[model samples]
Target: MRMAARPLAWLLLLGILLVTVLPIEWRPVTGEPANLERLVAFALVGFVFVVGYPRHWWLVLGLVIAVALGFELAQLLAPSRHATLKDAVVKVAGGSLGVTAGVAANFLFTRLVPR
Candidate 1:
């Protein structure tokens, strides 16, 4: 897990990028509903990113924020997507929570593990 974490983290981030730009009908509806998917998706991105680069978690945080911004902006040109400030805010907020969670988890794990 340690060795693969880095590449897996990048792949996860890339996957988000790919999914965002491509045309898809993947809006969060049903069950959890209303912005739930944003939380989960960004959270996963944050978790993998921090776990992969705990030594530079701040970089991961910045990268996630960049991802959020880039995706929202790219939506302006997407064929079926419409860009909106509201969506961008929700995405950034969700990404923020995710990054924080990742940082906290990494801190706790590192403290508990024998160095």
Candidate 2:
């Protein structure tokens, strides 16, 4: 069961990466805050990793940070996308929050369900 779950988890992770790397224009709809989308994205990614690999949450977090930094740096190559220290900070904050939430969720899940 664990082995089968691993592949599905990996596919989910890859999908997350694709979504993260894809560039999208920021246009806030009415009643929606500007940064809301990004925050959700970060949180979702962190949560996914945490749930998928609870034993290696730190490693997953580290990799997410590294990927975010790399993506930020890559933005410099595009004339439309300039890298910002603020964005990097936001990414780290979002990722961290997500990881924390995921950990908490995992704890709750384990407490509720026994192996």
lDDT of each: 0.76, 0.69
Which candidate tops TM-score? Answer: 1
Off by over 4 Å in 2: 1-31
- Candidate number with greatest lDDT: 1
If candidate 1 were superposed on the true structure by all CA atoms, what would the RMSD be? 2.3
TM-score of each: 0.82, 0.74
lDDT per residue for candidate 1 within 1-115, as digits (tens), equals 5567789877877776776777767643456754677667787777777777778778888888888888889987888776677767777787778778878988888899888
Indicate the TM-score of model 1: 0.82
Candidate 1 — number of clashing residue pairs? 0
Instruction: Return the TM-score for candidate 2, rounded to 2 decimals.
Output: 0.74
Q: Which residue pairs collide in model 1, if any?
A: none
Error of 1 at 103 (Å): 1.6
